[model samples]
Target chain A: MEQLLQQLVNGITVGSVYALVALGYTMVYGILRLINFAHGEMFMLGSYFALTLIVSTRVGVLQLVPNVLLGLLLVFLFSMGLVSTVGVVVERVAYRPLRRSTRLAPIVSALGASLFIQNAVMLTYGTQYQVFPEGLLPTTVWRVFGVEVTLMRVIVLAISLGLMAALYAFVQKTPLGTAIRATALDHDAARLMGIDVDRIILTVFLIGPALGAAGGIMVGLYYRQINFTMGWTYGLKAFTAAIMGGIGNIPGAMVGGLLLGILETLGAGYISTGWKDAFAFVILIAILILRPTGLLGERVAEKT
Target chain B: MSRSRGIALFLLAIMIVGVGGCAQPKAEEKKPAAPAEPIKIGVQGPISGQWAFEGEGIARAVNLVAEQVNEKGGVLGRKIQVIQGDDKSDPKESALVAQKMVAEKVIAVVGSYASSLTEPASAIYDEAGIVHITPSSTATKLTTKGYKRFFRTCFLDDRQGLFAAEYFSKKGYKNLAVIHDNTTYAKGLAEWTKKYLEERGVKVVFFDAITPGEKDFTPTLTKVKAANPDAIYFTGYFPEGGLLCKQAKELKIQALFSGGNAVNNPEFVKIAGLDAAKGAIVTTEPLPGDLPYPEAKQFMEDYKKKYGDYPKSIWVILAADAMRLIVTAMEKTGSAEPAKIAEYLHTQVKDFPGISGPIIGFDEKGDRLGTIHKAYVVDDRGEFVPAP
Candidate 1:
């Protein structure tokens, strides 16, 4: 029972990261209906950016700031800000130009962008796996409800949930959120109603990548390791989470991400670790077979 | 019509000139070989991916050997030329590299760091009747293919796995868990360890495999914790191995964590951190520094001076020794022909001294006759030292 509870905590912690990244997929697909495969690379770049900031500050001008938390916050902000710009540029260069050409064009372009970004990072950083700077985050393991949990895990879970809650409130209560919703519903109608559909789309790209960057920074701190290819596995899992939650549904992505994480962890813990990844795909297949549309997906009537 | 015909003629003339221009340089270059032609040896391995460090390290050692051989009046009075083929750590690319080496007519090939990459390339070399020596790939199935041309300097997974299992059992570890990355090498070692442990009346309480690049192993570690084994054997590369150790310690799993040669590197300690990595035992081919051979010590110094960095892994010495072995075979046979060199390596060469150690020739299966394997544990100082 303790083991089960322990895995549950681990699953939820990992699931929150998936949810954070899944939001980026759901948001982009919501507005642009493009998969934005390169979003995962944005998450990877965020960690690299934070790594550069932290390492660069360790010996130079920023070393005067002895407060680790303050330095970490600055690094996080700079990384998220830069990664958000990269997300916007990716959309503008790859997706925006092929907006009307064909749906397949942007999807293919996104894949190309992902490869380009991964290789670019590899060339710049060298291909070796880098150890994320140690002592940045406390490695204290806390006992909660008779289950062992790390301080890093709690921080990751809290930050991810806080970001998700903020995003939910912003989408539900704000005018810009309504414009995004309007644009997602009907691009032509949103533009006709004087909504800047392009700007709304750009805003979605920015918010999604920023959240992903946050998740990236948290993963680096929690795991204490980062590499160029780390994004591929995380991205694939997050993309699966998006699909499971209904591609364009925000809250659904969150629930789906957590569910997938829990199921995978439990399956790995109880059944076989080798089949952990297979469990996610099995659930996906079962879901697709049982309900053609996802759990929260809406049925759109076909026009004759 | 006349103007179009003239344009076609002009284009055809340019094509002929282009074809002739390329052929003339090749003929001219070959004409100057009045003496013995340089022996060509192809070095194939991943040069630009996750495992690029291993490949690059091995390639540097191979070049170093070639330079030293040339300095010693060349092998058989002919300069040794090393040609490199980058496998990119992919099986398909490895086969392509093998084909390129065949096309280059290399007398022998040294290479391919991982077992997965080496397996497919071995088939290509075997069919071409070229001698192929792998410096680091340790999968037992590699030799099981019965390919006469294939050989490896490193001990097979079964040998190392048996050594580890025996050590654990002798240390009174009754129940153990086995984990692998599902690669040929990892799985083979895990399976061998499990079989040997079971045979010794030791219970393998838990067995699992994790995806290669997955960062989060808490779920898997949680399961291993539940099993409550006395020891945990992880058969995978250093990156995942280090992560597993860190997570296992974080979970407060008190079981001893051990692995194969993949965990025998400074990077492993760096990733796992000193506290978590301490006492993590790894079964590996004895490092040159650890070996008592004076020549091994000299080779280490020479490697550092040439590469500007100490050899990080045993693959460096293994690669250099492989090249030296091939050149020695060529000199003994008085020819660089693949068939002659293969014959000499398979039969005549017995206890040939090289930098890493002595090559006691090869078995019928092309496995090295006698490869020493040792167990090392990460000390508190973050260095891998011989386990007491």
Candidate 2:
């Protein structure tokens, strides 16, 4: 029972980051109906930016940021800002030109953008695992019901869950969120209703990458290692989460990400560790076979 | 009249062809022993990927050796030219590098860092009748494949594993957990260690392999903690090894953490952090910084003078020694012919001085003899000091 509880904690800790990246996939697919393959690189670049800010220069070479939490917040904001801008640029350059063409054009463009960003980072940063500085935060551990959890895990989970809640609330209540949904439903009708569909799509690209970047930062803090190609695996897994939960649905991304994370953890813990990666794809295959529309059925994704 | 004209044209064509054929050999004779003809030696390895540091170490080592040899005099009246082939430490890229080496017509190649990569590459070089020698690849079957010219400068997995198992027993760690990343090198080491430990009646409480390149290893570590071994032995490269060390420390698993030779890198310490890396045991050959041989010290001094830092690992020194071995065979034979060099290496080339060790030789299997592994522990200063 204790082992099971610990595995669950591990699952949730890993899942939240996937959820964060999955939000990018879900949002991009929701509005533009374009799977932003480059979104994962945005997450990777986010980590790189944060690593540079903290380790390389430490926020304009000021060693003391008054408090570590404030310093971390500053790094997060800066990296997310940079990556979100990159995301918007990617949309304008890669997707905007081909929006009028066949749907396959954007998909191919997304893949090209993905490879371009990955190789760009590789060439710039060099192909090696960049180690994140450890001990930025304290190593406090808590034993709740005989399951040990660290301070970093708690912080990451709290921040990611908090971000997901804020996003869910905004999508439920805000007029901007409704505009996004309307534009996603019917771009022409939404434009006729004065929604500025292009701006809405830009907003989607911006916010999605911002969340993915935050996830990247969290992963760096937790794992203490970042590389250029890491985004691909994380992105593929997060894409699986988005697909499992329904690619175009918001809450579905969250649920699917968490569920996959837990399933992978428990599977590795109880079953064979060698098949850990195989477990994710096995579930994906089963989901595709059983429920092709995903856990939360997408709302009229078909284009007329 | 047309038939007579056709017969005359055929006769004229035969006379011109005969003259051209006769002139070809005289043209080759005209360039006999062209002054300053360079000896091209192919150096293949991962020069730009996850293992780029290792590749750079190898490349610099071979070049330093070449520069030193050239400074003395040209080998057989020709400058020793080093041609580099970057494999990116990938198997697919390795085959391409081998093809490049073949196309460049290098007499011999000293290359490829990992076992899986070296396997594919050696096959290509062997097929093309080129002598392929690896400095770091330790998989046993590399020599067992019956390739006449394939050789390695490192000890095999079983030998290294046997030494590790014996070392653990000497330290009184009877109960152990063995882990690997399922790569050819790591898995082979793990299997050998497990076999040797079982032979000595040591209980392997836990055994598993983790997927490489993925960061999170807590799931596997959690399971190992449940098994509650006296020690944990990780057989994998540094990137994942560092993470395992860090995560295991975080989990508060008190088993003595140890690793195989692939984990003997400064990057391992950097990635694992000071707190997690201190006192960790690593089984490896004599590192460049702490060698007892005269050739090794000279090479280290030369390396520092040339590059301003010590080579990344002992494998770098071995790579340099591989270059020396190939050059030695070429120099003693006084010929650049591959067949003579291969025959000389097979029959003679024993009791040689290597940078990694005092004595180096190749057996019938082309495996380097007299190489030994030492167990080291990371000291408080992050140095891989020999364990007492």
Candidate 3:
């Protein structure tokens, strides 16, 4: 029972990270109806950005700043901002140009963008893995309800939940959110109704990557290691989370991310860790078979 | 006489003496004749891919050895030249590299790091009757393939697997879980470990194969947990191993975890987190770092001076040693001919002292003979501290 409880804790921590990354996947897909493959690389960008900030500022200039939390906040903001610019540029260069070409064209472009970004990262940083800097975050273990949780895992969950809530408010209540929803419902109709569809799509890309970057930064802090190849694995899992919740629904993505995390963690803990990957895939397959549309997704009629 | 005329006269006298000296070497006191062409030693490895670090280290170490040999009046008066080619760490690429080296007429080929790469490439070398010595290949089947030309300066994975299993049994870790990457090298090592441990009356709770390069390992860990094994042995590289350790810790499966040489990396400590990696044991070829051998310290010093960082693996020194052996054998045989050098290597390579340990370049089957393995635990800071 203790072993089961322990694995459950471990799974949930990993799942939380997956959920955070999946939120970006779900939100971008929700608003734009495009799977932002480069979102994973965006997460990678966030990590490198945090790494850069940590190295340049904390190690170099921020020696004068006595408070650790202040240093962390600065590092986090810089990472998010850097990744935001990259996200915007990726959309402008890769996705926007193919806005009207065809659905296949944009999908292909996103994959190319992903490859391009990963290689660029490889070239810029190096092919070898870099260990995350030490002492940037607390590594203390916290005991909760007879279950062990690390300070890093708790931070990852709390920060991710906070961002998800903020994203929900931004999409549902704000004018920009209204514009995004209007455009997502009907691109042509939204355009006719005086909503700038292109701007909305751009906004979606911007918001998604920024959130992804935040998640990425959190991952580096939580895992204490960063490499060029990290984004693809977590990104794939997050995509699975988005699909499980209904790909284009914001709330669904959140639900999907959390549920997938818990399920994967609990499943791996209780059932079999060897079957963890298979179990995650089984959920996707089961969902696809049982409900062609995801939990929150509805079938849209094909335009002839 | 004027200054210019006197200088010209002196130069003319020196030129006559220089010409006289060139023609003075006669029958008895003459040095051996320099060969018409340089003796080419082929250096094959992945110089530009994932395993490029190891390849570059191998090539650099070999070239350094070649440089030292040439400075001491060259090998058999013919300068030893290194002809390098990138294997790209792929089997097909490695084979092509071998064929290219053979076509170039190299006296001997030196690398192809991983056993997978060496396995196919060695066949090409064997067919061509070209001598190939792998500095780092550790697969058991390479020597077993009846390739008379093939040799490695390290123990095969099976041997190390047995060593790890024995260590576990001696420590009384009776209930064990075996997880291996589903590769020929990893699986072979894991299988050998399982068989050996079982033979010693240890209860093998689980033996599982995980796919290589998969990111999430929670499911596998969960299953290992289900078996409730006292210890776990993983046969995979640090990338997945680190993540597995991290995930395993999170799942609260506190079984003592160990791995093969693949996990003997600094990246493992950082990736797995220090707390997670604590108490994790790994069995690998004896590194020059811990060995008290005299040459080990010298190589570490020279290597550190040449490259601004510590060498990644202990086998790199052995790689360099193999290069020295080939050049020395060529000189001893008084020829750069492949057949002569290969024959000399077999006959004269007994009890050769190298950086790793005593290396007999050829056993009965022409495989490198070495018997040194070390066990280590990752400290809190991630450095591999030799086990007490």
Best-fitting candidate, scored by lDDT: 2
DockQ (C-alpha based) per candidate is 0.66, 0.60, 0.31
The CAPRI-style docking tier of model 3 reads acceptable
TM-score of each: 0.80, 0.81, 0.80
Question: Alpha-carbon error at B78 in model 2, in Å?
Answer: 15
The per-prediction CA RMSD against the true structure, in angstroms, equals: 7.4, 7.9, 10.5
List model 1 lDDT by residue over B261-348, tens digit each.
8778788888888889999999888876786677788888888898787887788889888988898888888866676777787898
Ranking by TM-score: 2, 1, 3
Error of 1 at B345 (Å): 6.6
CA lDDT, every prediction?
A: 0.85, 0.86, 0.77
Model 3 DockQ reads 0.31
How do the residues B1-388 of candidate 3 rate in per-residue lDDT, one tens digit apiece? Answer: 6668755744544454344333323311232453445777888988878789989988888887887778887876677789999989777677667767766666688887888878766766666666788888866667777766666776777778778878998998989999888777788888889888988999889887665555556656767877899898998888778878887787678799888988988788778878889989999886667877787777778777877766777657778877877877777877665667678777788776777877765775666654677789987767888987
Q: Candidate 1's interface RMSD, please?
A: 0.8
Of models 1 and 2, which has the larger lDDT? 2
Position A141, candidate 3: lDDT: 72
Whose DockQ is greatest here?
Answer: 1
Q: What is the DockQ (computed on Cα atoms) for candidate 2?
A: 0.60
